[model samples]
Target: MNADAVPGLVAVLAVTVTTIAIGTWGLRFSRTTSDFFVASRTVNPRLNASAIGGEYLSAASFLGVAGLLLVGGAEMLWYPVGWTAGYLVLLVLVAAPLRRSGAYTLPDFAEARLGSTVVRSACSLLVVGVGWLYLLPQFQGAGLTLESAIGAPRWVGPLIVGVVVLVNVMSGGMRSITFVQAFQYWLKLTALLVPAMVLLVVWLDDGRPGSPSGSDGAWSVPVAGEGAIGLYTTYSLIIALFLGTMGLPHVVVRFYTNPDGRAARRTTLVVLGLLGLFYVWPPVFAALGRVYGRELVAEGHADVLVLELPRLMMSGLGGELLTGLVTAGAFAAFLSTASGLAIAVSGVITQDVTSRFVGERGPTASVAAAFRLAAVIAVSVPVLVALLSTNIGVARSVALAFAVAASTFCPLLMLGIWWRRLTDAGALAGLAAGGLGAGGAAVLNLVGVEGSGWGAALLAQPAAWSMPLAFATMVLVSLATPSRAPSHARRFLVRLHTPEVLEQAG
Candidate 1:
C-alpha cells in the first residue's frame, strides 16, 4: 500500500475551515474583556473538561509519546501517566483556591496577592516565555506530521497551524476557544481511534504478533544497565508533572475560567478521566507498532508510527483512505493544541500591553489591534525556534518546560495562596533561585550537553533540588523581610480561602 496525502490534506483543511466558521460565529457572545479572558467565568465543567483535554493533548501526546515508547521501550510510559496525573495534584492543591482568587492571568493573582507591580510584570513575562517554549513543539510536530503523512514541505504544517490559531484567537477569545477546543478533542480522539482499530486488525491478519518478525528486544523490557538511572528519571519526572500543574500559566488560567471552585474541581476530575482515556491509546500504538513497525525504526521514522501505520498495514485505495483519516487526526492535534497556547499567550500580551495603548492613544481599535499584534509576537519566536533547531527530543523539551514551571511559579502560587508569611521579597528570591536553577539546567540541555547518572540526574531532574531551593528561599526570605509583606495578607488569605458561594466582593 502506498500513501498519497492529497485527499487527506483536503479533508484536514475542510475540517479546519469548519472549525474557523464555528469559532467566528462564537464572537457575538464575547461582549467584554472578562468574557474574552475567562469566558465570563461561565464555562460548565463538562464542556470545560473536554476543552481542557483538547488543549492539554498537544503534539507530544499525539505523536511524541508513542514514538518515545516505540524507541525507549517501557521507560516512556511514564510521560502519559505523569501528564494525566498532574491534574490530580492540581485538584488537591491549587484548583479551587486559584479559581476563587478571581484572577484572569497568573500575573493578576501575583499583583492581587502580593501587591507588587514588579512581581506582576515578571510573572507576565515568564508566562509569555513559557507559553512560547511550549508552543514550539506543537508547531514542529505539526510540520513533521504533515510532511510525513501528506508529503508537504516542512513549513506547511506550522504555517497552517499558525494561521488557524491566529484566526481563532482574533475572532473570539476564551468564549470561542472553549467551544472550539471541546469540538477538537472529540475530533482528535476519533481520528486516532478509528485508524488504530483498523490497523490492529490488519496486522493481526498478517500474523505479525509481537515484535515485527525478527526484531528481538522490542517488548516491555528495561534498557540494559540503565535501570537505576531510568528509575531516577521516572520518579523525578513524576514529581515535576505532579507538582508542575499548579504553575503552568495556561492550565492555571483555565481553572479561573470556571464559574466556581467546586465547578473547577469537578472540571479537573473530568479532565483526569478524559486524559486517562486518551493516554491508554498511545501505549497501544507503541505496542502495536512494535509488532508491525520495526521498519520505521530501521528507517529512523519512529515518530511517523501513527501516520505510517495505515500504509504499512494495508494496500491499495484502502491504505490511502486510512492515511488520509490519520493525517486529518494528526493535523487536528497540532491545530487544537497550538490554538490553545496562542490564545493563552496572546491574552497576556493584550491585557498587559494593549490596555496601555487604549488609555494613551485614545484609539478605538487599540484593544483588538494590540491583541493581534501580541498574537504575532507570541507565536513567531517559537515558530522560528522550531524551524532553526533540530536536536531536542519532543518529550524532553516539553518536560523541561514543565520543570521550569514547577520550580518557579509553583512555589510562589502555593505559598502565596496558602501561606500568609509569603512576602514580595520572598517570592522574588524564590523566583530568582528556582528560575536560575531550572532555567540554567534547561539552557545547558539546549546547548546539547549529554550527561547520565549524577550528571543526567542534575540535567534530567533539576526540579527535585530546584523546587526545594525555591521553597526554602521563599520561606527564609519571607522571615527576613516580614515588614515588606502585603499589608492585606490576612484579608487576601480570607478571600482565597472563602467559598465562592459564601464570599462577597470587596
Candidate 2:
C-alpha cells in the first residue's frame, strides 16, 4: 500500500472493529425477539437521540452535503436545512402517537391502525422498496469513499461494508445497534468538526480565499436559476427532504426504541439539536472546497472533498492524520446507516414475509430464524444494485430516496395519523399512486433517462406533484369507499392519541 493509503485503510479497519465490538456488547441484552426488535423499548432519550442521528446521517449527510454545496452551489443548502427540519415535523405530528401504537415496523402500524391485512402487506412492500432505495446510496457511497481514500477497486468497498453490516446486524439486532449507533454519532461529529475547525484556520492563515465563482455574485443565493423549471425543482426538493424524514423505514424504526410516546418526542427534539449542530460543519467543508478543492468539482469527484480537504490545505502528517480521521467517520456513517436500514428491512420481512412459512413455530422461533433470513435479503439486494449501476453523487441518490418517501409514506403517516376517515382502499390507492409516480421517475432518472422542458424537471424531482397527488388520491378514495373503513378506526385513533401514562393507569 502507498504511504497515504495506510492511514485510511487503518481507519476503516479500526471503525469496523469498534462497531462490531459495540454490537457484540449489546448481544448480552438481546435475549428475546422484543429486545432484538425494539431494545425492549428501554432506550433513554439521549442515547436514542444519538443513535437516531447516527443512523439518519447516512452517506448523504456525511459526504453528500458538502459535495452538493461544492458543485451545486448554495441552492443545495435546502437539503441540509430540510433534513434537520424533517424531525420537527415528526415531533409535532407523528412521533408520540407512533410510539404509543406499539408497532415495530411501518406495516405493523398499518395493520394496527387500519386493521387490514391488505394494507399491512402494501406497507410491507413499500417499506422494503424505500429501505432498498435508501440502502442503494449507502453502499454506493461506500464504494466511492474507499476508491477515493485507498484507491481500492470500486466493487471492493461495497462488499466489505455489506459483510460488516451483515455480521453486526445478525449478531444482536436492534439491541446491539442502539449502542453501536450512538457511539457512531459522536464519532461522526468529531470527525467532521475537528477537520473543519483546522481547515478554517488554515484558510484564514493564507488570507481568506474568495468564493470559487470569483466575485461573480455567486454563493449569495441559496436557490439556483430563476426559470420556471428551476423554481419547480427547488420547491420539489424542499418538499422531499422536509417530508421524507418521517417516512424513512430506518428513521421511523428508531422511535420504536423509545420507552413511551413522551420519550419518543423528547428523543426527536434531541435529534433535531444533534442534526442541526452536525449540519453546520458540512457547509464549512463546502466553502473550503470552493477555495482549495476545485479540481475535484471539475473532475466530478466532489463527493470526496470532505475526505480530501485535509490534505489539500495542510501538508505532511497533519493532512494524513486528518484524512484518516474523516475516513473513519465516513466509514462509520455507512456502517451505522446501513445497519439501521438492514434491521428495519429485516424486521418487516420477518414479520410480513418470512413469518408466513415459519410463524406457526411461534414468535420466538419465527423471530429468530426469520430475522436471520431477512437480514441476508435486506443487505444483499441493495449491494447488488450498487454494484450493477454507476455511481451517482451520494447526496443526489439519497435525495431520490427522500422524494419517494415523501411521495408515499409522508401522505400515509400524515393522513393516517391525523385523519380519522382513512380506509384500506384509500391507503392502498395512495401508496400505489405515490409509489409508482415517484418510484418510476426515480428508476428512469437512475438509468440515465431524460426529457426536455418541464417533463424533465418533474421526472428528475417528482415529490412536488407526487406527494399532493397521493394526499388527494387517498382522501378521495377513502371518501368514495367509506364502507371499507376499518370498523375500529376511532378506537385505534384514540389509542394512538392517548398518553402512555394515561393508558397504563387504565
Candidate 3:
C-alpha cells in the first residue's frame, strides 16, 4: 500500500471496528421483537434525534453535496436547503401522527388506515422499493470513498460496507442501531466541521484566492441555464426534497421509536436544529473546493473534494490526519445510513414475506431468526446492484430515491393522517400512479439516459408532476368510492390528533 494511504486505511479500519463493537454492545438490549423493530418505542427525544441525524445524513450529504456544488454551483445549494427544510414539513405534518399510529412500518399504517390486505401489500412493496433505491447510493458512495482514499478497487468498498451493515443489522436490529447511529452523528459532524475550520484558517493565511478563471459565471446562478427546463428541474427537485423526508422508510421508522406523539415532535424539532447546523459546513467545503481543487472538477472527480481537500490545502502530518478524519466520516455515513435502510427493508421482508414461511405466532427466537435472514438478503441485493451499475452522482441518485418516495408515500402519509376520505382503493390507486410515474423516471435515469429536452428534464426530476398526479388520483378516487372508505378512519384520526393527556383524562 502507498504510505500516503496509511492514514486512510487506518481510518477505515478504526471506523469498521468501532461500528461493530458498538453494535455488539447494543445487542444486549435487543432481546424482544419490539426491541429489534422499534426499540420498544422508548427512545428519548434527544437520543432519537441524534440517531435520526446519523442515519439521515447519508454518503450523499457527507460527500455529494460539496461535489455537486463544486461542479454545478449555486443551483446545487438547493439540495442541502431542501433536505433541511424537509424536516420542517415533517414536523408540521407527519411526525406526531405517525408516532401515534402505533405502527412498526409504513405498511402497518396503511393497513390500519385503509383496512385492506391489498393496500398493505402494495405499501410493503413500495417500502422495499424505496429502501433498495436509497441503499444503492450509500453502497456506491462507499466504493467511491474507498477508491478515492486508499486506491481500493471499486468493488471492495461496497462489499465491505455491505457486510459490516449486515452484521450490525442481523445482530441487533433497531435497538442496537440506535446507539450506533447516535454516535456516528457526532463523529460525522466533527469530521467535517474540524477540517472546514482548519481549511478556512489556512486559506485566510494564504491570502484567500478566488476560484479559477475558467469557471462559468452561470455557476454562480441559482438556476441551470437551460431556460424552462432549468426552472422545471429546480422546482421538481425542491418538491422532492421538501416532501420526501416523511416518506423515507428509514426516516419513518425512526419516528416509530419515539414513545409517543409528543416525543416524536420533540425529536423532529431537535433533528431540525442538528440538520441545520450540519448543513452550514458543506457549502463551505464546496466554496473552498472551487478555490483549491478546480482540477478535480475538470477531471470529473469532484466527489472526492471532501476527501482530497484537506491534503491539498495542508501538507504532511496535519493534512493526512484531516484526510483520515473525513475518510472515517464518509465510512460512518455509509454504514449508518445502510443500517437504517437494512432495518427498514428487513422489517418489511420479515413481516410481509419471510414471516409467512416462519408462521405468524412463531416464538421470539423464530421471529428474530427470520429478521436476521431478511437483513442478509436486504444488504446483499443492493451490494450487487452497486457493483453492476454505473456510478451516478451520489446526491443525484439519492434525490431520485427521494423523488420516488415523495410521489408515492408523501401523498399516502399526508392524506392518511389528515383526510378521512382516503379509501383503500384510493390509496392503492395513488400508490400505483405515483410509483409508476416516479419509478419509471428513476429507472430510465439509472440506466444512463440523458438529453436536454423537456422530456429529459421531466424524467430527470419527476416529483413536480408525479406528486401532484398521485394526490389528485387519491382524492378523485376516494370521492368516487366513498362507500369503500374505512369505517374506523374517524376514530383513528381522533387518536392521531388527540394529545396523550386528553386521551388519558377521558
Best by TM-score: 3
For all candidates, the clash counts are 0, 1, 0
Q: Each model's TM-score, in the order given?
A: 0.93, 0.97, 0.97
Candidates' lDDT values, in order?
0.80, 0.90, 0.93
Candidate 1 residue-wise lDDT, 1-506, digit = tens: 22376767776787789779879988889777677788999999999999988888888888888888887776566678778888998898889988888888898899999999888888887788778768888888888887887677788777788888888888788888888889888887887788777777787778754753222453333332257665566667777787877787778878988999999999999999999888877777787888778788888888878888777778788887877877777777777777777878888888888666654433425666677777887777888888777737666778888888888889998899889989988888898898889888887887788875678777867887888899999999999998998899899888778886675453
Kindly provide the TM-score of model 3 when superposed on the true structure, using C-alpha atoms. Answer: 0.97
**What ranking emerges by lDDT with the best candidate at the front?**
3, 2, 1
lDDT of 2 by residue, 164-247 (tens): 999988888999989999999999999999999988888878886485332233443435476887788888988999999899
Query: Under the 3 Å rule for N, CA and C atoms, how many clashes does model 1 have?
Result: 0
What are the clashing pairs of model 2? Answer: 75-222
lDDT of 3 by residue, 67-92 (tens): 98888876687898899999999999
